[model samples]
Target: MAVPALDTARAAPHTRPAPAPRPARRPGRAAVALAPAGLALALGLWGIRRENSMWRDESTTYQVAHRGVADIFHLLGEADVAHGLYYLLMHGVFALWDGGLLALRLPSVLAMAAAAAGVALLGHRLAGPRTGLAAGAVFALAPAVQRYAQEGRSYALVCAAVVWSTHLLLSAVANPRGRAWAGYAAVASVTCLLHEFAVLAVLAHGVTLLLARVPAPIRWAWARAASAVALVLAPLVIVSQQQAALVGWIGRPGQTELLGFLALTAVGLGCAVLPLRTSAAISLRTLALPLLILPAATLLAVSFIHPIYVDRYVLYSYAGFALLTGAGLEAALRAAPHPRAGAAALAAVAVAALLPYSIELRTPQSRLDDPMAAARAVRELTRPGDGVLFMPARRREPIMSSPGEFRGLKELALAQHAVPSGTLHGIELSAPRIRARMMTAERIAVVTDPPGRRPDDTPQERTKREVLAQHFRRCAEREVQGMVVLLYARPGAC
Candidate 1:
């Protein structure tokens, strides 16, 4: 009565109530957000036990982190300065649970999962929700991502930090605030701290900022954030440079590397040209194209002056590749008559393509050297008190990682044990001392680098070879993956 019998039909037009708030969209949004992390964890945990043995690089991680923290810090100064931060993180991991291989590699698995989530989130911010889901899924399934996800190394962690930092960067650029920029700086600094090469991601960010039509304030904020990150990372960069000899083994980029880069460029370009929806303020092409190409290109260009390019060093670049791949697939599916079916078919093809590589990664052959296999071979062949020799001196590394396999045997050339010496391979005795010890042993076991590697021509190595030749006969020889084991005994005394 007070409302005068209200104009019901007119009110109906005005007060439709926003279409009931669309509860259905909430579930779909949640699924898209969570899918990437779920796929990452499932794939990461699938073959967690397949590669049971630690490879040489992973063995180095285990040995280094297992050392007392002080010893690890001390060793970092002399060698492995590049992995110092990762080792320190692992030191804490081992302290909580020393449950062998699983314990050592679990952190990487978790880190990669977080990285997958971040990749999805970044893709979503750059392109859309569908692209984010696709990108994250692609990242989880990429061969390199799967490889590092299962290995005990810093690359996966670095990739995670880079992806999240990129996400933070997008946020900072859109809403230029002190706190947002500071968050970007902190996350990027951590990424650089994990692996100094990750600082190259900032260059990718710079390219994104330059290409985007952002306001001056946002660009200046990004520049300030990047400068802060560099300042924080400068100390680590200086220390890592002083330890440059650690990477001396990396030769100039070869034909294989060039081919790989070309392939990556082709893929990124293909994605950029696709008719994907992107914001005019900051296009996915602007961000993803540079992120995918520049870091590796910059590293390769610099390699002409100094050979610093290693594929794994720029592993975070793969996240960009993944994002591009995701966007490309989404564009193709959207163009198709049936988008969901197209997406399913595309996913199935991706899984089929990745299956073989995934299987190969689980095998011992995936690694350059299997220290665990070497350790097992040694354990099977040797008896207590058999003298051991590392032919090139560096071959001692595998044994050092599994000292228990060599517990009762005498390390004929070792001047000090790795743990006691705080070194990777323990120091070797002088040439004279090594030769003298060789002559007295009735039986000795030798571990050598794989056959056909250039022989070590150093005096100590020469003396080692000569003494074994003159005083003993090869009683038995067995080859293990990435190594050779020879049993030597006095003439007529097998």
Candidate 2:
């Protein structure tokens, strides 16, 4: 049996029935599909209004965008992000729109919502319409996706491109045609522009198509897609120094924490597929594996050598995995002899699974994400020569480091608002140095979260507040609603 030629397959008769462009479902069917999508998106948008409290990353984003394109290129020419693509795009965004938190972040929110739609379409194409609807609905509700979507970052956009590219990957496998490969190219190109890690996604697709074990042309199509990505990434490779430095901090994500992040990735994926189960079957197997086992295994496996333990690092895997899981569950439901039972099981799993995620949604952690607020509030509070010292300055470093919308301090610096005359730097410093730095300053503030610093940070760093308090006379502490906006003066800075 000679392998079927691409041309012959192209000429082959359409055997799979064309989907009837069915006259619309009853009035609410469309509404129901979109209901969760809308709610998720709306809430996400609302969430970001407060998301920008001048955190280190957000500040950097704002600052980088504030630079001239030439300067940005020069910086990228120096040290860059997951390939300088997001920063380069952000450069244009800051120029056109207000770099305010909400303004800076809208693009990601829209992109995330668009991704939700893609998840639905991908699910629909792989499983069926119901699966598509369920996938879209679940994508909309996802806590992590929503959290990232509302912020000004590369993750949400990457998620959208991943969905689009995954759909094309699916299409190419199902129908190995030139046009399908062409679609793959189109989507893969966007993924390249959005993130370099998306390269992993392209690789995954190659493995998928290879497994489909299609004819030469189909394999060639994947080859073409891979080749395009390589060609596109060639220019970016010039910035390897920048890329390595950014990722240099790959501390071993302890086995438990590493596994936890992987689990979180799964929960997001599983939720996207749960509702699309067949009407008669029952079981959470679909939601259990990719959203659960596979990611856990992937992380555990990856964490050994130098720890590939970052959650956002594997964002591409999370989306595609979820779609496949959704597709599988849908197939199981449709194939189940007891469709009603299958449906009931899926619903039960959804309730049980989501109840925890939902609880997480309602918690304080969800709302405390205001990194850019510090700089914004600082801008409003300061007078000329109002000396600003970020005592236990290490906590403030991430914010000050980037100095932009990523941090909210970029524009402030551009406007020449605060001078970095003195800073405590770290908690390890003797109380005298800390006191000396604090006492000399007219207006001193320490940037710390009351509960604690970032969980991933060192234990020594967590003592920032306690150590600083011993030396500096706590003049006036300002709790800016959610963040620890502590205000201290030198023992006496009149």
Candidate 3:
């Protein structure tokens, strides 16, 4: 009996020294990881709440789409631009949710959060849980990430899709089974539709399969799936062709913008790869290389032909680059004979990077006075028979681009005023020109942004301000929320 008991004790699963208690997840790990994303959300919410005063580009989104979702769809089929799908999605979201700044901004917030979670998961899977956690934390705190989170744009969505698709790719490559493959295919298709840069994901996957020696059958399946996507996107490529002229107008960025873009790209990708530095040295560098190098090169090359050089056009690359950088950072630490020293150093650097961002975002004033409050205030001041001139309004015309587009300046103007009927003009004419033209009107608000240069200005357009002083016996200008609205009335007309 004693001998038998001895044998059982020796065979017990716990016999190997309690298997070194699993490393306690870093203290307050969940909270620490979540901090960055929370900060981003808070900042984003505060940022867009105001009379953002429709930039010319922003104005266009409103004009046509405001008519109805159906109208947006029709525009997409006819004269829509590269961002049509995203614009379409926003059109529906706005129509259903009332198109408030908060509502339009919510989608980007969700996307940014989704991206953070995906980064963590990818980092964990690529290296270990600890690595994943660290990478995710850094990503949430990145400044570039915060900037895009509040805007009603597609960059945040593209970022999320890229990170998530990468996570799916990790699973698919490892298992390459029905569910994994299906997930990969579905995500890839959606990503492609969201932004064409998603095609780079397929290349990344191919590299991963090659490095891992995935089964031949699985590789062949991935190839077929990619081929199907290429075929579907072929039409989009043709569309890209038509847009070439418009896109080409954006010349190679000036030196400063290019430098800033490169820095942000580095910061974004660095966060993604920092957590997964072990188990697969391949996870960080190799994955990031194709994403960072190829897509940028391709876009720049095409810019020569098609002109798609906006940073957001390749926003998806930021996620992949972050993952790669995180992996590299983690791997360098693990490679050390004593990883504790390297880990401490990494943790310190991460803290340093995140602290500034956290502080900047926590303060709303730094982001600027609440825009939403200002917009609402302006609306209240509006009264019937009052003409509000958007002075130097031509620059802001892009924000309100179409005079009658759905989500553009027209909607904003209509929402606030009872302009039963009149043309909304974006002219350089001074207060006198406006006052003289609408002599019957009792009050006139000449609205315009600060001065900006133009290639050409009509002779009458110049010195209109000096001319206004001469014609309008009584003229007063007040800065209403950064807009110079000069109210002109006859000497006794007030």
Candidate 4:
């Protein structure tokens, strides 16, 4: 006799239940995502100009972006190939508005907003809407995120690409189809092209696939997509290597960086071990833990042999941090006897804690040096026909950024203009030529790094110092936030 049908509907004790269906995209989804994007935009725009200040790096962006497209392409071949795309994008931005610092920085604000939205939607897909909103909010409020959101750099755009690509990766993992994987690969490749360090993020994505415990076929699909991204990035990697000296300044992680990483890792680990289930198919811990840790940890590890660890390089990891933090907050809310009150209290505490940092990030003092402030000082210290020199040629950035401030001051050691030469700073005259140029000036303005910086020992820099010391007397000096402006006159003229 046929055995009575085993209880068809009943679950086996050992086997997992079929995963709950993936949440269908709802009409409210856009609204949910938009909330965080709006918040990030508002925060980014709050002090976008930073008291009419721009720093050395931002000045670089301004000068480069204002160049002709052909010139930008020419410059990319020599240096900063990594930021080629961003420079091109900013070219378009300035072409349209040319609103000075506001135009220079608005793209970053918009890109960061997009990134925040991506984080929210990713969290919603993995956990729930509440978690998504909380995660996005956390990311927006993160001091680092706030800092970079207003920067005129590629980091924010790279962050947007990474986050959205990860969102697509989630979709591909859920569906495991060719089109889905292709979509993921396309965006992932762009992310890498934006900045090759984003390849670290792709590696983090691989760990995420493994943590997801997806089927063999899905694993292969992910691998194929990731490999394709790498293949597309190969040329950039090669070119950037030739320009490695650009980042040669990075050093092994310092104590403060190490401590911060460890503390954040501890918090992430705690969130990962929370007794909460994200979904039947994948856990929030699996999705976010690797995203949060792998990119940073790998960079930190590699820095021992070759120090390339900069916190901004892995800023996308903040999305992961926000994701896990959101879950932890949600878990706390669920476990509390009064969820609404608990959320209110949590919100109040988070705002209070982050408010000071938020305000600090918008000030001119937030950056290493204010180029505008230095330029202003140069303008005030010297008259028309006076010679202006940068102690290290690189310090010319402030003058380059605000050339109007030093309108009639001669750049005594000049050769070619920066844009014409396709270099960050123009090629300086030889040491002998610079010294001879210095000898003729009646009064000179010199911009130096803040006191105690290791003095540039290059021959040209040495010549500048020697000429100034031997021939000129200090007439006046002013120390700005991160720069020193000094006026020198012929010994008798002083």
Worst 10 contiguous positions by lDDT, candidate 3: 414-423
TM-score for each model: 0.93, 0.67, 0.69, 0.93
Q: Write the per-residue lDDT of candidate 2 for residues 1-494, one digit (tens) a residue.
A: 34567756876676556878986453234543465457557757664655334344555566666666666665665455453678777777767876577667788878877777776665555445666665566566656775677666788888778777766766676677788878788778777767665676676666555544557677787898789778877676656644565566677777667566656655555554545443211122332233333443555566677455566655545455545555555566768999669878887887698667655553335554444555555555544544444433434543453344132222111112212221112124444444444444455445555555454343333343444465455655555534565555445752
Q: Tens digits of per-residue lDDT for model 1 on 252-364?
A: 89999989998988998988788987743678888888888999999999988899998889988988898898999889987899987888888788889889988988888
lDDT of 1 at 83: 86
Q: 2 or 3, which is superior by lDDT?
A: 3
The residue pairs that clash in candidate 4, if any, are none
Q: What order do you get sorting by lDDT, best first?
A: 4, 1, 3, 2
Best by lDDT: 4
lDDT of 3 by residue, 1-494 (tens): 79999898889876666556786555343553465456446555654643343333344445544545555554554444556678778778777886555666689887888787777666666667666655675576566677667656777988888777776766776677878877777778777877777787677767767766767887887887788778777787687566555444477655655686677566655655444445553455556556665666566766656556766676666566556656565666667897778778877886698668645643433342232323333344444555544334333342333222212112112222111211122223444554354554555545555345342254434434444465554455544433444556657755
- Identify the runs in model 2 with alpha carbons over 4 angstroms from their true place: 1-40, 51-54, 173-183, 235-238, 241-243, 261-300, 324-364, 367-369, 376-384, 391-443, 446-474, 478-494
Model 2's alpha-carbon lDDT is: 0.57
TM-score of candidate 1 on Cα atoms, chains taken together: 0.93
Q: Model 1 Cα displacement at 453 (Å)?
A: 0.1
